[model samples]
Target chain A: MSAERQGAASAAPDPRISMRGIVKRFGSVEALRGVDLDLHAGECLGLVGDNAAGKSTLTKILSGAYVPDGGEIRVNGRRVDFRNPADARVHRIEMVYQDLSLCDTIDVAGNLFLGREPMRGAFLDRRAMRDGARAMLDRLEIKIPRLDALVAQLSGGQRQAIAICRAAAFDPEVLIMDEPTSALAVAEVEAVLALINRVKASGVSVVLITHRLQDLFRVCDRIAVMYEGVKVAERRTAETDLQDLVSLIVGEKHVSKAAGAAAGPGGAA
Target chain B: MTAYTSRPAGSRLADMLATHAQLLSIAGFFLIMVVIFSVMSPVFLTTGNLLNVLRQAAPILIVAVAMTFVITTGGIDLSVGSTVALINALAAILIQFGIPWQAVVPALLLIGSAVGAAQGWFIAYQGIQPFIVTLAGLSALRGIALLMTEGFSVPIPGGIGFVQIGRGWFAGVPAPAWIAVVAAVAGFLALTGMRFGRYVTAIGANQEAARRAGIPTRRILLSVYVLTGLASAVAGIVIAARLGSGSSNAAVGLELDVIAAVVLGGTSLMGGRGSILGTILGALTIAVIGNGLILAHVSPFFTQIVAGAIILLAVWLNARVFSRLAAGTRRRT
Candidate 1:
């Protein structure tokens, strides 16, 4: 895999996107406190934190949903400013919001196309849209029964799948997802995890935020733990176990038993 | 997973029926109304009276077409009747000033767009609720009309081409009826076939989602009100032409009738779902009932009661019966 080749070639690979000293505040409450993050191409970075830990805020800044009060963002080493979500989209950044962002009354194909509908001389090219939507779903191996069904009629998993498909279909350079599997059934979660792997394999950088700690081990190459709006620690998947990550996430000064016993002196690092 | 397989081909008919249950039921109700009216009044079934009904229904039908778009966006344009009255009075005043009807018509339509755009600005940009904004417009606009006309009817001069819009016939149909037909057809095509219609539904379905998806939602919202404004102007012109006069009191309750027609046609006031065909049928049904009642020698006062009752009954059947049928079929499948 290209990702494997890159990992072996350098101790610190070049980042596709880099954020430095990102700061966000709501009135007197600071949501993010000068955070720095780097996402390499073709790698899934897991961002884990408890409630109000600023994980959502950081990702929203990257996705251009929120403007940081102080920050420098560089995409492929070139500095950029994102005034709005549309600006982020121009740089090929797409986000699957926590709410899935699917319109319930719109049909599957309609939701898939959403804001940018295919048109022929001012009229919606519905036939082409349906055909394109089918191809997109098929490419993602999403087993939706009907493309014409209203999104509200779909199961939670199916709706999630549609939302992911819409974001993925745009060929984004960086895809950010917030709590994607939070409300999914076990089987649906498996489907989404598999989908994440498929997206990563296609050479897109992915930033995933999830409370499901176990999920980070499955798809993430690296994990960043946040506490109280600060990036407390970062670890490569090969170097860190779940207990050590959990300790970092919950802000424990002492390492957990499994981690302490397994790594000895390395546990402190 | 196997349970999620494509629906059996044999059930396609059932599926179509279930999906379109609301539209089908409204159509059926409209036909039943026609039969009942035809039986109760001999004149109701005649070509002359039918044309007259269409002529009278023209204003409601035209405005209702635009209202469908507004409602589809989950918004209501309560100021439409006031817009119509203002345009009606304004058109008469212009005609009386010896301005050409040709110049007056287009100018009124532009004024309508300006009025709609102004309200849309408040609703979409200023974050005012559509109901409150349009309600304000409804009051303010009518008051402006009253002020302009000094609470009196402004008479239009006869023997002018302006009167032809209301009085003339085209290809064996009233001109106003023809205008309504064109409006209905355009509404149907725009809603079903055009990108604008898709955005309208999307905005109504979920404004945030639509905005995040890169749709210019606020502009689209603004445009729908503009559409209603333009439509109300056309309706006003037709009314002034038909009566040979314009009054501030004209079409006082027209908004309610237009909204009733749209809702009766199964276009949800909650938005994101609409059918232009249903609106047409709804408008015609209202017209037919009113005309038939008059012909049957029923008091005009009772007409409102019957119309309201029928609307309630039709909507009830739509929500209750059709939903149950759909649910039962889903369980069976």
Candidate 2:
């Protein structure tokens, strides 16, 4: 654990969102143990950890997909309890899940405005959805060839782009993304990374969870490393390099320079 | 960019054809059958015979329209036939017992909706397999109808206005056919143009995804079965009115005919894909086969044989050939 973590967070005095002592358990398996996280508005915080490190569980709790056994979340310093995803959504918190959570048979515009569709009287407003989806994609600088085509017909990067754009469309105060680029080709990954930065520029606090160590350097202002079910360390991206994050993620004692080099080079592997 | 993006890199015409290839395949089959029947029986294409065909096809079309909703959600209501029979027998017995025909219609429609709601509750809320739940209904509903009538056909008086729903004609078309048209148009609107249709497609395409997106998946799923139940009631009423009697034996195996029409029209059992237009065409095709075969001087038994064969062949080709083609298109795109 680094002593600098506390002050090394964003220079912003008031964090837009904060979670403290967020403990969750799946029966006897404790998935999250007293985790604390913070996000400043208009900045991306990267949550990095290995499998079963409870990164997903922690994010799911924040997104109201799961309830924490013990914890409190604050938005603008106001305490909030979210019983469901809808509750979290009311607070302008949104998440793009790891599975993508997209219907392959639906069109791009349909998937983008899924839960809250544009309706004119009794039917869907197709022209509105089409024009709106185009503007949404353009705002994020992602290009999807056809808005009417089924999502199954899109490239991996384009699908990921749609998911990100969908979450961003929530006009969220805090946006959480889980491995948004884990399934993309190289070019596509860059496109998504660029999307995240653009989204961050719009004053939305972003939580990004990814295993790709170098990606943290590109878009993240700060990196939080979790070991097992606990947050072992947090670092300002400028102060820490790949070696320190690699060591911290695997439990600082066993991280060798050789091991860090192998997992280095900023590729997903 | 607009020109390039408006049309994908693939040939737009080819894409359109490929996208609706299932619909076109069924349409082509329907047209060929019509031509063959017209050639064999000059009466097949005549106005009177066509009107008769529409009248006969009406009940099946009404129920199949609702079944489209059920199938689109990746479910089967095997009890639809029994539902029709139960309503048919129950309506007749009520009329015989001195209840006004007017009072019985809406009451039976409610009963039909209740039957569907029960099955849907079990499937959506209790986590029961839809097949098992509806299969139980298939057995139990028909049995209840048999008990109500004691295995005899109940006579419905020929003079009631209720009979108009089956035998009367308006604008030179049978009343039943008009009712069927309303059901089909409403169904087409719900499946193609409404938010209900979009959510139905999303739920079928990926239920968990739909749920996470804040769609009320369970409610949508349950409501689909209810639609089937309500449609089945209308069909039963139409059938009883036409025959002037009702029996527990009515519409026996009718579920197969409706399902065959739906599948033949290219609604995939896999649940995500549905086509109401394709369903109307498919039902009409089946009606023609039955009506045309008799006119062609073929044995009536062969009509059943052909309908059953067409069901098996359509499903086989879809599973083996069409799915492969769809996958190929998806891969290329």
Candidate 3:
């Protein structure tokens, strides 16, 4: 946020979030092997790869939904361990999952403040919640018919907005979006893209995991390519071509065995 | 191109009707029932008969209110009937045991909540299917109730106050009706106004999403079931007081009526939607149907058939209304 912090962020390679030698296994399948990643503050880092590239596994580990067998996660240059998603939230790490977790029976305000609701006296302060929800929606430039409307009645994009609003309201230092735009239409996707831009501008580090290269080019400042389980390459969005990135993901270009062993693209480490 | 756009408007109107068509259809059916009953018996329109219906509906209303919470979270409790029976039997037994009514009542309420929480723990944290877990509880609780009563009725303490709490009229209405109204209001507040209420709805809506959002989901689930159990216990106590006796067989087959009320009230059995007000209406509606049948001199066995039909009709109408509302909203999208 300060100039010195910004200078340190650009000068030193200390990422806002850093994962080194992360390994995760589900049963016999090693989903991720020795994967390493660096995410700088206020940067939109795109994670691009094929379906089995372990993007979700990496996301899960980073979000504290899953613990990796071997890895050190350093947040804001400080080494930390997260036991659960709640712990991750405390460390200013939040995720907007593709499913857009929400309660459809309640109104938008109730959904936005699902876990952490404002309270006055013994009551839930529904009025304050509604007003605060409206403010958050406005801040994110989200348009909905009414704050009191039940989420079940919302369009896909509007539901997505509620999820984004919740994460943003918490003001998490790292926001991971797992294909946030996948379920949306064109206009809705644009709306989400605008929100991403606003989040990035506000200096919250973003990790956008998507197979949509066009989305990566539109919003990501830097792109990280993951081939199989390992992060194979990191390229500035302006410097890297999509073809080169695709090549890196498919392991077409020559890569070090350490990286290859890390990737396990051949299904063996 | 114009027709494509223009036709949607007609379709939109049609969809709106389709979505809410069930509500209209149900309302029509309700009207038809009322007319038929009125024609069949002049006594159906009397205030005394209406009050009698409400008084009889009170216990089911209390249990159904709690059931709405459980069902909204996509769960069910077959144990409520057993729970009510146990409480009824206990209230009378405790009174006979020389336990003061003041302490006896609170103890029963706490015991009810504990039973509910016990069941909830198995469902919420253990990841057990609610139907299986509650069905086990349904049978288990009845066994416990029978054991407590030794398969016999326990006589009340023969106190005027205890009977007054159950059967006495405060202002031309039975005390049970008033207790039910109070409980329903309290249930409504706990669900819609408090943090716990919101969490329950959230869990019902999407448990996985709520978990990701850092909600204490399992705890909330446990608490909802406990609340339901406590409500059923209260219903049981009232039944004991009203009868001046507690029987192991008390509240037998009451689950069907409670569930009927819940479905009629428009709470989705599938999870993630419910209304306390609707459930109350449902309770009253079921009560009215039963009362009308009894007044019309229909066989008691036929009452069960009528209740089943009403429940089926309510659910059908609810689905119809739900689809129409969904279509209405979808058209806008």
On lDDT, the candidate that comes out on top is 1
Task: Tell me how far candidate 2 lies from the true structure as C-alpha RMSD in angstroms.
Answer: 3.2
Candidate 2 regions with alpha-carbon error over 4 angstroms? A1-14, A265-269, B1-8, B315-333
Docking class of 3: acceptable
Report the lDDT tens digits of candidate 2 across residue range A112-187: 9898899999999999999999998887777787798888878776788888889998689889999998887777
| Chain A of model 2 scored by TM-score | 0.92
State residue B235's C-alpha deviation in candidate 1, in Å: 0.7
In the order shown, the candidates' Cα RMSDs to the true structure are: 4.3, 3.2, 5.6
Candidate 2 local lDDT, residue B83: 98
**Distance (Å) between predicted and true CA of B4, model 1?**
9.1
TM-score, model 3 to reference: 0.87
Tens digits of per-residue lDDT for model 1 on A1-269? 12333431134445788899999999999999999888888889999876899999999899887889998999988899987777888899999999988888788999999877888887888898899999999888887877887887777778888898999998999999998887777777887888888899888889999877778889998888899998888888888887777678766764454444533322221
Evaluate candidate 1 and give its CAPRI docking class based on DockQ.
Answer: acceptable
Least lDDT summed over 10 consecutive residues: which range in candidate 3 chain A?
Answer: A1-10
State residue A214's C-alpha deviation in candidate 3, in Å.
3.1
Determine the TM-score of chain B of model 2.
Answer: 0.94
Per-residue lDDT of candidate 3, residues B83-157 (tens digit):
998888888888889888989999999999899989999998899998898889889888888999999988996
lDDT of 1 by residue, B152-225 (tens): 99999888999999999999999999999999999999998888998899888888888878788899999999
What's the lDDT for residue A177 in model 3?
92
Candidate 1, residue B188: lDDT: 99
